[model samples]
Target: MAEADAFIFAALQQSGMLEASFQGSSWSVSALTSDAFIAIVFQFLTQLQTSDDNVTFTLPSTLTNTPVGVAARHRVGSKLANILKELGYAGDCGYNHFLYPSEKETRNILSCFLSPQAAEAEDDKFAIIQPQSFLANTLPDVPLSLESVSPGIAGGDVTSGDIIMESVGSSGVATKNVAGEENFMQTQLSEETEEQALEQVQKQVDDTEHRIAAMRKVLDRERGELQQVEQHVLETQTTGQEMQKQLARQKQLITMLPQAQANIAKLESIFQKNAEKKAEIAQQMESARDPLLKEYAQLESQKSNRKARCRQLIREMKTFRSDMLELTGVIHSKMESVRALERIHERQLAKLDKKKDCQDEGPMTRNMYTARIMDIIKQVHKQKQDITKILDDIKGLQKQMNVASEKLKRTEAVAEDKLYTAASKSKTSNSGKSEAYVECYRKFAQVRELFEELIVLVGDVGKKENIARDLQNWISQLEARDSSSHLDKVLADLESVRHENGTLQNELRACSA
Candidate 1:
C-alpha cells in the first residue's frame, strides 16, 4: 500500500500536478487537504470543456465545517468523478473515488488514465491552452518571484501561467487565504509568482477605459439627437405661431370659395357635355372595329390550318427519312455480301482453270508409261539385293567391333588395377613433379585404398549389404535428431524474444510520464 502511494505521488509529480516546493510524504497529508487538489480538478475540467466556473479554489474545511462546505466539496468531487468515469474508469467510481480513495485505488486510477492513448488525447485537449501560454510568456517582464508568494499558494502548485479566479466567502463562513494581492501566480503574466489583485486591477482599468470611450460616443450621439429634437420643436412652434396668419388666409379662401364653386359648377356642365360626346365617339369606334374583328378571326383560322398542314408534312418527312436510312443500311449490307461472293467465285474459277491446265494433253502415251513402270520395278529389285548385302557386311563389322571393345576393356581394367594398387611414396615428393602431378598422385593413393576395400566388399556380398543398411539407419536417426533439435532451438529463441519484450515494456512504463 505504501508502495502504491509512492507510485501515485511520483506520477502526480511527473505530470506537473504538484509544485516544486512541496515536500509532503503522503498525498493526504499535504496535497489533498489544500487548494492544490481543487486546482488540479479545475485544470482537468477545463481540459475536458466541462463547466467548472463555480468550483471553489479553497480547502473544504477552510470555508466552513457547515453543510455549505460539505456540499461544495461534494459538488466538485462528483463532477470530477463523472469525468473520470466517462474516461473509462472502472471500480466503485463516485465522489469518494477522488476525495476518499485509497492509495492503491489512486494508483490504479492514475495508471489507467496515464496510458499512451490517454496521453495523446490529453495533448490534443490541452493544445487549445498553448496560445494563452504563448501570450503570457511574451508579456513584458514583471518583478515577481516564488519568494514573494505565500506559503500556502506555493505548496504543490502546478503552473505559473493560468487564469486568475479566486473564490471568496460572502456569508458568515471564512474561506482560506489561498490567493491575495501578492500571494498567487497567474497566466496573465509569465512569472514565478503573481497576484490576482494585479489582474483584477488591469482588467478593471481596461474595462473602465472601454466604457469611458463608449460613453463618450453615446454622449455625442445623444447631443445630436437633442439638437434634432430642438430643431423639430422650433419648427413646431413656428408653425403654431403662424396659425393666425393661416386663419386670415383661410378667410380669404372662404370668400373665393363661392367663385371656386361657380367654376366647379361650370366645369361639371362642360364635363357632362364632353361625356355625351365621348359616348357617341365610342359607338362610332366600336362599329368600325366589327369588320376588322371578323377579318382577324378569318386570318387566325387560316394560320391554324397552315400550321396543321406543316405539322403533317413534317411528320411525313420524318417517317420518309427513317425509311430511307433503313433502306440505305440494307443496300450497304447487300453490296458487301455481293462483293464477298464475287471474291469467292473468282477463287473457284481460278482453281478450275488450274485443274484444266494440269489435265491438258499428255506428252507420252500408254506404252511410254508401261516402259517407265518396268524400269522402276527392275531398279527396285536391284536395290533390294544391294541392301541385303550391305546389311550382312554391317553385321559382320559390328560383331568384330564388339569383340575388340571387350578385349580393350579387359586390358584397360588390368592396367588401371596395377596403376592404382596401394603403395607408399618416398617421404619427400619428387621435385621434378608438377603441382598437378603431385595432386594426382595424392588422389591416386586415396583411390587405391578405397578400390582394394571395394574389391573385398564386392567379393563379400553379405558384408557390403550390412554396411549399406547400417549407413541408412544412421542417416535416418541423424535426420530425426536434427529436426527435434532444430525445433528446440526455435522454441528457445521464441521464449527469449518474449522475455525481452516484457522487459522492454516494463522499462517503458517506468520511464513514461
Candidate 2:
C-alpha cells in the first residue's frame, strides 16, 4: 500500500502543472494559480480528512540525518499538495499558504470558512477562504493553531488569490551505498550465528545418543548378570535343602546310636551280676548237710523252670526278624521318596529362575511369568508338604522299630532277671545250693544263647553284634556245676543212709529217756 501511494505521488509530481521541491529536507511545497487551485485543495483536504488518510514516511529519528525514505517522503508530499490545488479551491500550495497540506491549517480553514457562527463574528469573515467539501459546511468554533510552523503561516486570517511558493533548502549530499553495505554485514553475521547454533545442537544430540547407548549396555549387562545370579541362587537353595534333609536324617541316627549303646551296657551289667551270684552259690553248696541237700533239690527244680523261660526268648527273637526286615525296607523307601521330592524341588526352582530371567528382559507382561513363578511356588510348597509327610513316615517307622526292639529287650531282660534271682537264692540257701546254682547257670546260658539268636535274626546287612559276651564265662561255670550237682546227689544219697542209722539211734535214745 505504501508503494502504491509512492507511485500515485510520483505520477502527480511528473504532471508539469505545478512545481514541487523540499525545504530543509523536512517540509515540502507545490504551487498553482488560485482560481481552480483553492477549490481543488479544499476538496482534497476534506477527502483526506474523511478518508482518514495516513502515510508512514520513514525518516532518520534525528531530523538532521538524511535517508532515502525522507527524500521520497518530501517528493511525494509536495506532489500531493500541488495536485490538490490544480483541481481548484481558493489557494496555491506552499508551506505557509492556506491551501498547504498542514493538517491543522486545513481543519481551521474548514471551521472558519464554512461555519454560520463565523458570519456572526464579522471580524472572522476574512478567515473565509473558499466554498469547499461537505465536512467544510459543518464547521464548529474550534480553531487550528499554526504556531509550530513559521508564525502566521496557513492561518484563518489569510486570504490568498495569488499563488505563493517558498522552501527551506538543504545542500548535504545523500549516500545510499554505505547503508546498503551495513545491511549486508548484519545479514552475514546473522547467518554465521545460525550456523554455529546448529553445530552446537548437533553436538549435543551426538552426546545424548552416546549416553543413551552406554546406559542401554549397562542395563543389558546387569540384566544378564542378574539372570545368572538368580539361577545360581536357586540351584544353591536346592542343594542346601537336600543337604539339610540328609543332615536331619543323620542327626536322628546319631541320636539313636547312644541309646543303643546304653541298652548294650545295661544288658552286660546284668550278665556280670548273674555270673557273680552263681560263683557264690558254689561256695555255699560245699558245706551244706543232708537236710539242706533235700531242700536244694527243690531249688534245682525251680532253676529248670527258669531255663525253659530263656528258650522262650529265643522263639520270640525268631518272630521279630520279619518285622525288622520290613522296617529296614520302609526306611529305604522313605529315603528314596525324600530324594525324589528334592529333585522335583530343584526342577521347580530352575523353572522359576527362567521365568524371572524372562521378566527382566523388557516391558513383558509379567502375568505369565508371575503365574509360572506362582505355580513353582505352589509346587515348592507341595514338595515341602511331601517332605514333611515322608519325615512323618520315617518317624512312624522309627517308632515301630523302637517298639519292636524294646519288646525284644524287655523279654531278654525278664529272662536275665529270673536267672539272676535263682542264682542269688542258691548263694543264700545251704540246702541243694550246688544243684540250684548249676541249674540257674544253665538257664542263664540258655538265655544268652537266645540273645545270640536274636542278634543273628535281627542282624542288619553288613552289621555285627559282638553279642553280650560277658555271659560266656558263666556258661563254663554252669557246665562245671552240672558235674558238681551229680556228685551232690550221690553225697545226699549216702547222707540219707547215715541219717537213717542216726534216726534209729535217736529213737532208742528217746525210748531210754
Candidate 3:
C-alpha cells in the first residue's frame, strides 16, 4: 500500500502537479491536496481513454483509514461524472466505491461507473478535451465529511468521570485527525491557499492567451508581406517578357552579320581593282606628258628666235634703202652739172667754126682751138658714163631689197604653220590627260564611298560580335549553374532568329536589285 502511494506520488511529481518533501520516514506532497491529486489522476485516465479506446489503466487496490484516501476516491468519482456529462453521455454515473473495486467485483463495479446510455454512447462518439480544461479539473476542491462515526461506540455505558475522560480524549483525537486531514487537503480547506492557487492559475491562463494573440498578429503580418512579394513577382515576369522580345530582334541582326561581311569583302576587292587601274593610267599619262612638254618648249624657243631674226632683217633693209636714196641724189646732182658743161662746150665749138670760115688764120691758132674743143668733148662723155653707172647701182640695190622682203614674208608664214601644229598637238594631249584625270577622280570617289560604307558595316559587325560574346558568356554561366534545360530553349530561340535573319537578307537582296 505504501509502495502504491509512493508510485502515485512520484508520478504526480514527475507531471509537475505535486511537490514532494521528506517527513519522518515518509514522503509528503504539498503542491496538490488529496482532492486535487484524484482530479489529476482522473484527467490522465480520461486522456488515455480518448487517445486509445482499446487500452485501459487500472488503479491500485490499496485502501486506507486516512480521510485523504477516501476523499481522493470521492473526487475521482465526481471528475468521472463530469467527463461523462461533457461527452454527452446521459444517465447517472454511480458512487465512488467503484473506482478501485476488487478483480472479482470489477464487472459489477464497472456497470455502476458507466450508465447504460453512457456505455452505449462510448462505442460511437468520442469527445475532444482541451488542455486548459484538463488543468482546471485536475485540481478541484473536495469537501470533508464527519458523518462516518460509529453509533455503537457513542452509545456504550460508562461512569461519570470515565465518560468525562473519554470525552476529552475523543475531542483531542478528533482535533489530531482534523489537523492531519488538513495537511492532505491544504489548498481546498484553507481559504488563503485556495485563493493563492486560483490567482496563480488565472495568471497562467492570462499569459497563455496573450502569447496566442501575439502569434496570431505575427501570422497576419507575414501573410500581408507574402502577398506583396507575389505582386512583385508578377511585375518582374511582365518586364522579363519585354526584354525577351528585344533580345530576339538583336539575335536576328547577329545572324545576318556573316553574310554582310562577305558582301563587304567583295566590294573591297572591286575597289582595289579600280584603284590599280587608276594608278596605271596615271603612270601612263605622266610618261606621255614628258616628251610632249619637251617638244612644246623647243617650239616656243624656235618661234621667239625667228621673230627676233625677222625684225633685225627688216631694220637692216630699211637702213640700206635710205643709204641708196642718198647716193642717187648725189649722182643726179653730178649729172646735171655735166650736162651744163656739155652745152657750154657745144656753143663754144659753134663759135669757133664760124671764125674759121671768116678768116684763114695762122696754123698755130687753128691747132690751139681744136685741141681745147676735143678736151671738152672727152670730159662730157666721162660724165655721162658716171651718171649711168650710178643709176645701175641704184636699180641693183632696189632689186636686192625686194628679194629680202619676199624671203622674210615666206619665212614668217612657215614659222606660223609650225606653231599652229605644235599648239594643236599640245591641246589634244591636254584633253586626253584631263579625261583620264576626270575618270580617275570618279573612280576614287566611288572607292572612298565604298570604304566609308565598309567601315560602318565593320563597326556594326564588331558590335554584334561583342553582343554574341556576351550572350555566350551568359549561357556559360547558366550552364555552370546547372540550367542545361534552359540552354536548349535558348539554342532553339537562336535558330529561329537565324531563320528570320535569312528571310530579311533575301528581302534586302531583292531591294538592292
Tens digit of per-residue lDDT, candidate 2, span 287-353: 6666688899988887687678676875785577567877777776666566566656666676766
Measured against the true structure, the TM-scores of the candidates, in listed sequence, are 0.22, 0.24, 0.23
| Candidate with better TM-score, 1 vs 2 | 2
Q: Evaluate all candidate structures by whole-model CA lDDT and list the values in order.
A: 0.58, 0.58, 0.58
On TM-score, the stronger of 1 and 3 is 3
User: Model 1, stretches more than 4 Å misplaced?
Assistant: 1-268, 280-284, 287-295, 325-329, 332-336, 342-513
Top candidate (TM-score): 2
Model 1 lDDT per residue over 389-464, tens place: 6567556655654564455445434434433331112224444534544454566456546645854664476466
RMSD of each: 49.9, 51.6, 62.6
After superposition, the stretches of candidate 2 with alpha carbons farther than 4 Å from their true spots are 1-307, 348-363, 422-513
Any residue pairs clashing in model 1, and if so which?
19-156, 19-157, 161-187, 162-187, 184-194
